[model samples]
Target: MSDFLQTRVGAALKDAALAAVITLLLASIMVGLRTKTEQGGLVIVGQWGLVAWMVGVVFVGRLAMSLLIWRGNNPVANAMNAMLPKQDTVSKIGKLVGPLLLLFAVTLPFYGNRYVIDMGILVLTYIMLGWGLNIVVGLAGLLDLGYVAFYAVGAYSYALFAQYFDLSFWVCLPLAGILAAFWGMILGFPVLRLRGDYLAIVTLAFGEIIRVVLLNWYEFTGGPDGISRIPRPSFFGLEFTRKNGFADFFGLDYSSMHRIIFLFYLILILALITNFVTMRLRKLPIGRAWEALREDEIACRSLGINTTNTKLTAFALGAMFGGFAGAFFATRQGFISPESFTFMESAIILAIVVLGGLGSQLGVVIASLVMIGGFEVFRDLEDLRMLVFGLLMVGIMIWKPRGIVSSRAPSVFLKEKKSVSGDLVAEGEG
Candidate 1:
C-alpha cells in the first residue's frame, strides 16, 4: 500500500484518466456530432473521430500536467526554470519586446496584406478594451461582469450625436467617451455597497439593461437592424474620397487600403494612450488607493482612503477608455448595434485581463494578441475550434494559474522597486 501510494506515475495515470472521462462525458455530445444542411434536410453527421481526437489531446495534456505536479517530484521543471535567464535579464528583454512589437505593428500596414491589417485593427481594439477593464477588475479589485454597457453607450452616443447633430467623428469621439463615463458613474453609484459576486451580478444586469433598452428602443436605436452607414472618421478633416482623399492630398494613387491602414493606426494610437494613462495612474495617490483597496478594503478604509471614490474612479476611468475603444469601433465599422456589444464582448475583455495578469499592462497586450489573433488562426478548425481552445485554456490555467506575466512591479515603493509575483496579490475577484 505504501509503495502504491508512493508511485507518482500511478497517481498521474489515475488523475488523467478521471479527467479525460469527465471531459468526454461533458463535451462528447457537442463535439461528436455535426449538423449539415443537405437536400433532404439537416443531417446529423457523426464526428466521433474528432471527438476521440479532442479527448486524446486532453488526456495527454492532463497526464503531462499531473506528472509535473506529482508531489514535489518534478526536478525537471525546477531545473528548467532555474536554467532560465535571471529576473534582471528577463526584464531587459521584456523592455525590448514592447518596442520591437510596436515597431512590427507600425510597419505591418506597409507590408502585410489587407486581411492581416484588418486582424491587427481588431487585435488592437481588444487590447484597448482589456486595458480599460484592467483598471476596475485588475487594479481596483472590482468584479464588473457587464462592462459592455459602457461600450454600447459609447458607440450609440457617437452614432446618434453624429446623425442628429451633424457632428463629425472627431466631435463625437470625446462626447461619446464622456457619455459613457457618465453612465459608468451611474453604475458606480448603485453598486457602491456591493462586492464580489453581488457586484458582478449587478454589473451584468446593468449591461443587460442597456442591451435590452437598445433592442426595444426602436424609434431611437433602430432596433435589431442597427444603425448603418455611420460616418467614418476623416484623415484630419480630409475625407477618404478618391477626389480629395488622403491619397490625393499626399499625391499618391488612391486605394481602399488607405482607410484600413488609417483605422489600424487610429486604434493603435488609442491603445497606446490607454496604456500610457494606465501606467501613469498606477503611480498616483488615487492609483495607490486603488491598489490598497484591491488588496484589502477594510484596511484601505482604516488607512484613511475613501473607498467610495476609489471604486467610482476605477469604474469611471475604465468606462472612459472602453468608450474610446467603442467610438473607434463604430467609426471603423461605420455602424452601431447592440448585438455588437453583448455580454460575450465583456467576457472576452475580462478574460484578456485575467489571462494576461491583473494590473499588468504588457500582459494584457500578450493575452490580447494570443486570444484575438489566435481566434483567427484557429478559424479553420471549425467544429474542433472551441474544443481545442478549451484545452489550451485549461493547460494555461494549470501551468500559470496567476497568468503569463505573473509578477507585478509595485506602483509605489519605499525602497528600490522590486518585482512582486502576482500570486501575492489578490485575484481581484470582487
Candidate 2:
C-alpha cells in the first residue's frame, strides 16, 4: 500500500512537470501574439502573462487527471458509479427529459431573451452538423477533417442560386442539400481506399480546395467579398416581413422575435429530421454495414458487404445534413464567406460528435449544449476562455475518456437488450 501511494504521487508529479513544459512552449507562441489597442496602436506584449497562466493551468489539469482520473481505484469513479442509475432507470429519465426539453424549446421564443434564443439557434445548428458527421466518423469510422467542405458547398449553392436566379429560400434549401451530397460523393470517390491519417489529409485537402475555389472564383462566388443579403426562409409562401408576414397574417404584433423564433423552429425541425433519419438508418442493413465496416473492413468484406458503397453513403448522408445546417446558417446570417466554413468549424463539429460519445444522438445534443453554450457563457472572459474550454475538454476526457455516453445500447439482442460499456469494447468493437 505504501509503495502504491508513492508510485501514484510520483507519477502525478511527472505528468504535471511535462504538462508545464509543453504548455510553456505552445502557449508562448499562441497566446503571445501582438494585439491592436483601442487607439489603433500595436503592442507585442502579453506573452509572459499568457505563458504563465497557461503553464499553471496545464500543470494543475495534468495533476488532477493523473490523481483523480487515471489513478487506480479512483474515488471519483467510485462515487460516480454509486450515483449512476441503471440502464432501465436512465431510459425512464430520458423519456421524461426529451418531452420537457421539446416543450421548453417550443415556448422559449415567447419567454426567452433574444440572446438566449440566438444561442439556441447556434447550438442547434452545431447539433445538426455534429449528427451529420457522426454518421461518417462514429458509424463508418471515417476520419474526415474537412467535413466543412460540404457545409461550404451547401451555403454557396444556396447563396449563388438565390442571388442570380432569384430563387426563393424554400426552393433552394433541398437543392443545397443535394448539391452538398453530390460533392460528398465526389470527394469520397478518390479517398475510398484511404483510412486513418492519410484519409484525414485527403479530406483536409478537399476542404481547402473548396475554400480556395470559393476564394478565387471571383466571377461566380463573389471571392473574398462573400455573398451578402441572402434572403431568409419564408413561412410557406408568406414572407416574414414586418408589414405582411406571419405576425400580420395571425393579427399579432410583429416583433423581430417572430423571425428569430421561426429560424429556431426551422433548425429544430431540421435537426430532428436528421436525428430521426439517422436513428431509422441504424436499424437497416446499410446501417449495419456501416458499423461492420467501421469495426473491420476486411471482416466486413469477408461477410460480403460492399465497403465502397457503405462509405459513400455515410459520406453522402453526413454531407447532406451538413448542407442542410449550412443552408440554414446562410439564411439566418443573411451572409456567408469561406471564412464562415473554415476547417475550425469542421474541428468543432467533430469535437462535438466525439465528446458526445460517438454514435449517440442524445450525447451529441448534450455536447452541443455544453460546448457552444459554454463558449457563449465564457465569451466575456476572452483570453481565459480557451483555457477554461481546454480544461473542460481534458477533464471530460479523463473522467469518461470514451464520452459522456460511453455505454452502447446494442441494436440487436437475442434474449434481452444490454448496455455495453465502452471500457469493455476494444477499438472498432462497435
Candidate 3:
C-alpha cells in the first residue's frame, strides 16, 4: 500500500480506539453499575457484560466506518459507483416511492395491528413536523432549535381551551394552530438579525424558556404533573362511546379501534394538507424568496426581497403546521405535558430534516420511516439504543451530511428545462 493509504488506516485505527474508550466510559457509568432492590435494600450490581458488548460494537463500527471512508475512492469502488443509476434515474425512483408509501400509509390501519397503527401515528406525526420545519430550516435557511415550543403551545392551547371553555377538538384545532403561529412569530422577532450558531442559540433558548414556563407555572400549566383526561376528538359530533356513538350511528358494533383508525386518518389528512401547501408555495414568489434566503440572505436582500417578512412568514407557517400536529397529538393522547416538549424533540425533528435531505419532502418521509420506525424495532435494546443511534448520527454527519436523498428536484426551472442537483447547493451555509 502507498504511504498515504497506510497513514489513512493508522488514523482510522486510532479514531476507533478513541471511540471505544469513550463508549466504555459512558456504558460503564450508565449501565455497568446499577442499583437493584433486594429485600427492601438497595444493592449495587455490576453488569460488565453489557458494557463490554457496547464497547465492542463501538470499536467495530468506528473501524468499519473508517475503512469505508478510506476505500471510497478506490478503483473497485469507482467501478461500482459508475455501475449505479444516474441522478435522474434515482430521482425517478424516489418519486415512485413517495406515492407507494402514501398508498401504504392510507391503507395501513386496515392491515396493521394496534401497535403498528400506533407506530404509524407516531411516524406520521414526525413526518408532519419535519415538513413544517422544512419550511424554515430547509427552505428559508433558518436554524430553529426551539421548534418544539410551538408544538407544546399547540398542545396546551387545545388542552386549556377544551378544559376551560368546553370547546370541541375541531374548534381548538384551528385555534391551537393560530396560537402556535403567533408564538412562532414571537420567536421570529427576536432572532431576525441572527444567523448560524447565534440563531441556533436563540432558538434553543426560546424552547427552554417555553418549557421552563410550563414547568413552573403549576396553576396554569399543571407544572410537571401535566394535564390529563383532555377530551378526545369525535367525528362530526359523533362520540366513540357504546350508545349513540360512531358504531351505533352506523349500525355497527362498537370497537375502540374506531378512534385509533380515526386518529390515523385524521393525521394522514393533516400531513397531506401540509405537503400540498408546501409544494404549492414552492411555486409561488414567496417560496422562491425562501429558497433565495436560504442560499444567500445578503444576495436576497440585494435583490430587494424583504428578508424580515420572508423570515417571519417562514417561522409563522412552520409553527402553524407544528401546532396542527401538536393539536392532533394532544387529542390523540388526551394529555398535555411539559415533558413531551423538550429540546430532544427539536433535535429529533431537525435530525429528520437533515437526514432526509433539506428541502426534499419525499426525503423527509423516507427518513422519518427509517429513523422513527427503526427506533421502535430496537425498542428491546433500550439501554444501547441511544448510544448506537448517536454513533450512527455521528457517522452520517461525518460521511454523508447531505443526507439519504442527496438529490432534490428544483421548484422552478427555466423554459430550457435545466436540472439542478442538490450537491451543487451545499446546505447549512446559513
Over 266-352, each residue of candidate 3 has an lDDT whose tens digit, in order, gives 999999999999999988999989888888888988999999999999999999999999999999998778999999999999999
| Highest lDDT model number | 3
- Least lDDT summed over 10 consecutive residues: which range in candidate 3? 414-423
* Total backbone clashes of candidate 1, pairs 3 or more residues apart or in separate chains: 1
Local accuracy by lDDT, each model: 0.89, 0.87, 0.89
What is the TM-score of candidate 1?
0.86
Question: How well is each residue in 97-170 modelled by candidate 2, as lDDT tens digits?
Answer: 76787787778778889999999999999989999999998888888899999999988999999999999888
Arrange candidates by TM-score, descending.
Answer: 1, 3, 2
Model 2 backbone overlap count: 0
Clashes by residue pair, model 3:
none
Q: What's the TM-score of every candidate structure?
A: 0.86, 0.83, 0.84
Candidate 1 C-alpha lDDT tens digits along 1-430: 6677568887777788888898788667787777899998999888888778878888999998878744554786787677878978988888898899999999999899999999999999999999999999989989999989998988998888887888999999899899999999998997978989999999999999999999999999998988898999999998998897788899989999999999999999989999899899999999988888888999888988888988999999999998988888899888788899889999999899989988888889999999999989999988798888788778889988987787888876787988887778886547
Q: Show model 3 residue runs off by greater than 4 Å.
A: 1-84, 416-418, 426-430
The global Cα lDDT (0 to 1) of model 2 is: 0.87
What's the best-to-worst order under lDDT? 3, 1, 2
